[model samples]
Target chain A: MYCRQPLRTIETIDDLHYNLQLAVELEFSTLPTYLQALYSIKEGSNTIAYSVIRSVIMEEMFHLTNAANVLIATGGSPALNSPEFIPIYPTFLPDNEKWFEARLLKLSPQALMLFLAIEMPGDLVPISMITIGKFYENIEKGLKYLDEKMGADLFPCGTLDKQIEHKYYYGGGGIINKVTNLDSALFALNAIIAQGEGAPNKHWDPDKSFPLEDTTGIESGDHQLFMQPRELSHFYRFNELKKGRRYVLGDSHNSGPTGPEININYDDVYNLKPDPQSGDYIHYPELEEMNFNVNVIFSRLLDQLHLAFNGQPKTLETAVCTMFSLKEVIQILMRNPIPDNELGEYAAPTWEYLSPEERTLSSIR
Target chain B: MYRLDDFYDLSATLTDYPVTRLIGTGVGNEYNQTLSQWVRQDVLDELYHCFSQLERNNDGQVCPQALRHQLLSNEKYGPIARNIIKMWYLSIWYKMTDNWSMTYGIPAYSSPVIGVESPTPEDYIISNNAYIQGLVWPLMGSHPMGAKQPGYGTWSDAPLNSIASIHLQ
Candidate 1:
């Protein structure tokens, strides 16, 4: 649904709670897709990818906790375990069809594109487009509508208030009616994005295209194997084994999967090594897209963990260590496409194993 | 000029004292005399000069709008001005608390920002003028106060009362 008002202008604790709720919802929405992607990976070979996905999913739980704490600290009740909490993917939004799409479990270039589109909607445009891109807009509308119906402000408590008491009934503290404004809205969005993706383009600044060829290990001609403009370099690449296409040394012409030009030699990449037992190479329809999704989810989780500990030094150090361990696990996964039956080795460190010092100050709680 | 050590010592003393007792003693009588010396007229004058520049109108009271506007107006002085405004407000509250203690034999407790309609001993025990000031202190430049205004007022009144009530009590 399109928001009747802008979200960036939010000024109260209620607004913060609402926005946090939206964030939690979005993270939850991504869960099923990620889990489905994890399941789609080859049974044994996807161990590391599976671990990465699982760890991120678990950390998202921590994010929800932090959001809840902030909400409570501001005298708002955190709505968890609610019927509306679990999102039905590809659900139609009020804005437009392109804005919402059917959830697809299969991994492919199209799937990855869909995932990216969902994860990062287009700029917050006043004039709604076919895609009706901004997710925050929907939240803004929902909050405003609720406020009008209730006839009370949310987060009436000001910043100077000493203690935001948790009230059992709804009327104690005021509700926040407005969402943050576009600039501030973008700042919060970008803060999360930058922590995951690199920094976003600044105002009036020319987009500095980082050619796909510059990515570590991957060559330019290899770019043609996937899709191109190859100029959109900030996104994750899902280069998988394709049977027919020749691995080019330094070409950068491919654009996207469904576009007029398709450069991937699916047969060549996948068929190179066939399984002796099955007399076929291990292949899945959209392995590249799946790989990309896994990578993006893992990277984003690491970023989120980093953000959780942003200001608190002790927590930051612990988070960094955890992140380092996660990175190590990812590296192992990258090297070994599939591991032996065991999965625990590749998984993130369990809470039990965390040092006492680390455990005491964890922001995860 | 007030030395950092003196400031730290005053802070330490304030930190240890009971919140209610501190409020009643007023600014001068409660804390160590050594620390109080630095906070006297000289410091107040310097603070007043800073406050005058920050106050948007000639009004003596520093309203949220005025504080927000002044601190956010310029790049060079914004952060420092904001911090000083916070510190000044806190210092006044602290002094008032001591005054309350001296004027009234009973401790004048600070009120809780939310839920409480009147002052209570719990409020006095828990409140810290400087710490609360540090929490709401604004950052540099003309950023919108946005959602912070209401909370600021609610919390600001607690200290304001702890200071002002001393005379009446």
Candidate 2:
């Protein structure tokens, strides 16, 4: 057992931008896997497990936005369209690269356990170690140090429009805000930590008083939800699902959710094969076609998001529409069984990025 | 003889919807059940066997023209194909015309038919679930009333495609 050395924090603006981009990719990497589990549920059978995974994925999207905003606020472009942005399946999440691998599997005991590990709270980590929470903490320190050293021009002027504010995103339960300056940027980091791995308290939403207004309204003038009791942060939500229970108001992180029992039948899930790839379906042309279709839309979404982060913020509305359209194809993939697999599993979208030559229907055919 | 895959392939030709999109509607299996219960077993088998012949033309691609000539225009299988399309788009399965039924009908008419205007029992909305998932919703760039709503402000966007474009290589 050797002593662990402290990992280097972001020391420059370039360092900050690079690390934040990694944060964006890191946050994004979990989505396909988590959504696979969410969509795998036979409709209305595992409603409890379904919603838990759904909420977690929503928060992960919010985290991606925050990371992109921080990268943009530091005068850096969010590079997302390249193939490198999408990590190969069964790959390690940057935080867990050294020890564990994340996979694309349907909701089962294994997937839930993987989620628990991915969102494991920093408080649970040994000191002098690097977890995702520690990664963010280092970014927080880097922001402070750089803001002091660089003085007034740290975050450049006229880049404020690049940040995705509350006006851009809407709907169910992810904290949306802008990152304009040091305070707002730091607040973004705090929200990521507080909601994801738990704040130092291990069970509190940072800035508890932050107002979440009517998600549908163009701007706030109606139905502002204030001081709603904190929902389970990511780590604890998975824990509750794994424990087959709920976390009540007074429960601590380690309390293991002693509320009313929740039931999820593992048999109700679609049998998604672990870590499917585009090449895996050469024998299954229609599955390949469906899989390719998913990649086209998925790639388009990444391009649209990149555009939204860099300059064209209004594109987000269209982006949201594009995101919703993905459900149909993914559902089709999940519901159909893989034709001849020995495991009798279903096909799933591999979340691969299509090259420009492969993007067009005619071109690929 | 009663394979869902053949039924899906057959349905794709009749409905002009991708097999994937057809399944995505969450009623393909139900539509298959509707076919089994309403149509004669031999007729269903005859219709599905056409897909096996699909391997002959266009290098194994699904050709609407061939299906139209062989099944859609056939006196025996034609009406069945038409009803399959209706069941998918409108969630209602129409009984064969009196002459066709007299010639080739099964006697398993389950009650709870939604169409009461005709003197004889005519058709049914398969289920409330089926009606809500009707292909009409996606076709019209809208959703069934009080179900699967895109959300609050989806109306402003351009109409999304009813079917994702399919490419076979």
Candidate 3:
């Protein structure tokens, strides 16, 4: 139901920036909910899922950084410390009064559904529709504003006229905009859905073979399968794993009000009980330490950039390279296991690790 | 109108010494060397090339008067030039205070430099912003040039405040 709308249109730099910022914020906003959900799951039962979630969280941080860099390059400060940064679970949509609501927090079947909804392809939210989804409209307006303000120099790569492709899409569907090629599209998909959804290729539904069947029915067909049925699997697998039961693949599970088949519920053999109140959650008090360590990493990276730029010919170049290095660190942390040791126990890799090749691009520094 | 040389000299003086030099030193040895070379050559070269077209005389030195005239007359380059100036200032500020928590090994709010004894929940935001701005703005010999000052306005006005609120919530 959520993925039925068309892609939101973007025309200008501000629109891109605004949406980009919102995407970054949303990525972070999902973390608290994700952590809560992960912790609620019985420990050791959802190792792969947990790993995926952690990776997504880390990549979200990367996206946030990328957005910040873009904002800075365009002469704007990346505002993470805004009240709007973290919305209360299920905040009201920007303009719509009753049509749509943006959920901030709350662990429910609907919560996961909402996650699925937000993450559905951009094109699903029909650009023509008004009441069903307004994100497209917002994007269109933002793009217009940006185009008016910045003109054609919006993209840093200087290939403004090139057709961009969508980052992530359902196997049978068309790609999202501004994601021209497979690499960029994959990168975008990775940034948005890579962590929480498991492997990128695995996201494709194998059962429903391509040349996607069109069932326009509101409560029947693909829409039903997409919204109500699939979400239940999220809850069911979670419940089964908590009870130490073997959650067979393709078995129907109820999530919130919806019911769906369990796609890949690995570690079903592990007998893990949910912490009564928390229920099926991963308990790691060290997460705070990880957060602090990340902050330290960011600080150190900035410090290094400052040193490398010392009034030299290649200051900007070095800054860009440092940005790339920071991105690599974020990527590594996303995949790495959570350090169970004391604070600052795990040593973060340096820029050298990020840039394996020691080739100096510029002689300015 | 004054010559291009004057503008080059002025920009070089502003970008090379004082704020840039100060921030560069504060960044420590490795960072300082990298930046010094970057300033003298890369950034300077770009600025000179941009100003060359606007140069009134063949002589390289463009006086302060000439610089002002170019800024006012040129449309395409004016905003970019101003932004570059602002960026330098912001860079200085960012470099100075980016590491407050790491440097002192204390929380953001409880900084002695900002006069917070036992930082209230609110104090953290103000102190963090002050620290960050303090470092970033000086490099360009300017501050965050906006109508809303850092401390004033809604808690949302200051980024640090907003961030703190989010985390606490």
Candidate 4:
């Protein structure tokens, strides 16, 4: 199918590597936007709303690691520090249609709707092989093609030692798989696809709901019936929040959430600046300090991830702690309101980490 | 059907605040079941028999003065009644043994460590749900951290009416 579509001419292993870097950047970009929106919700209200968004954000982190692991497995350096790699928001998701703009948003009806679209399973907007699902499908094909031609020397440029093992991640959705071979790589790719966008490899009917795992705790006596219903997909989970309810037993593909009403207090949310940039905080010294601390923690998180992928599993503890500590810093930023802003917005983390050179330059300035 | 309420009145002689108020915290059903389990069936039967033995006044109207005197002042039933109230308030089950003078007993009641103040508990460990549902939350005017979260900005406002009112709204 990828050969049938007009692709970006993947003639060599380097081309595959380039696309993997693009995948990494795409996965890395969503984390900031999701976290900013999650932190905007008031401390106690919207318990279900908080859990649903958090579940997605953790999976996005998992997806980032998966993409990097695949690149390392294929003997390619996973470049995370490139300047252009940090996405400019209101931009399209990696290979999404040009019309769908992914922006930093508060936890509003609008934000929930956008989350639904961003994670909408299946090729909702299929434009030649550009859907994220299709892009990964093409990567799977590229892996097979390289292996067939080069045999034992397919991934000669990279080493297995660079792969981030499953032990680094602390409790989330799927396991962090090492993609050393085609089967393992395909498993990792399928998790990214089915867990976010539905799988294309399974020969299930296109019109029918995608075959996902049944994570919904539905009570059932019939073993076959219980086994059949897939867990509500990520798209469906956000949709449940949008509908202001939960999915209960017997709710199916055609059915909506029939569970008890979830009381959501939207009026009490923090007013965060939409698509906030690192450049925007320069004028306010306090806000600038907040942004700096956020960046420092994030940089340390990346450094920890780098070390964990390189071989040391013990550093993952620091990575987990840094991930949680980022939330505390972002929470503080949420409390400090931005001045002279008519829109009634507050400070938020910009998700931009400065390198040592950039940090020295800022200090000098 | 023999309702547990027939055998014991948590509201009548136990809690100062209405027992129903604690029930409104949303952990009521499980809390009640756990408390019932903690107070064994034989103890409840003894409580029912003791309450029945309390003599009514000559006018056939039960005197509140006499009822308190009959229940709390008795030798055998006094501590058991007190422990029931403590179990509801603190969610900790005190052992029902009358052998406070005994030097030692079962392994469950094994001696405390050198620095520790008390011996190990023989009463079953209370469920975490019961601990969260303990009468203390209403006294503090807050729910447990992870369970039954009161809505956003609720802290700034007065506590829920459920804390004060006896009747279910």
Top-DockQ candidate index: 2
What CA root-mean-square deviation does each model show from the true structure? 26.8, 6.0, 25.3, 17.7
What TM-scores do the predictions have?
A: 0.31, 0.84, 0.30, 0.61
Candidate 2 C-alpha lDDT tens digits along A1-365:
01122447767887777778778888998998899899899877888787778777877887888889888888988888888888888977754434567899899999989998788776676765567787788888899999999976678887878788777655435556677789988878777776677554455543243222222111121222222334556787788789997766455654556667889899988888889988888888778888888899898888888898889887777777678768766887777777778989888999977777888877545
> Which DockQ values do the candidates obtain, in the order shown?
0.01, 0.37, 0.01, 0.01
Choose 1 or 4, whichever is better by DockQ: 4
Query: Model 2 has how many clashing residue pairs?
Result: 0
Q: Which scores greater on TM-score, model 3 or model 4?
A: 4
User: What would the per-residue lDDT of candidate 3 be over residues A328-360, giving only the tens digit for each residue?
Assistant: 333222322333433312122111111212123
Q: What are the per-model numbers of colliding residue pairs?
A: 58, 0, 80, 3
Candidate 4 similarity to native, TM-score: 0.61
Better of 3 and 4 by lDDT: 4
| DockQ-based CAPRI category assigned to the predicted complex of candidate 1 | incorrect
lDDT of each: 0.33, 0.75, 0.35, 0.64
Q: Which regions in candidate 3 have their CA more than 4 angstroms from the true location?
A: A1-16, A93-108, A122-365, B1-169
Model 2 earns a TM-score of 0.84
Best by TM-score: 2
Error of 1 at B146 (Å): 51
**How high a TM-score does candidate 1 get?**
0.31
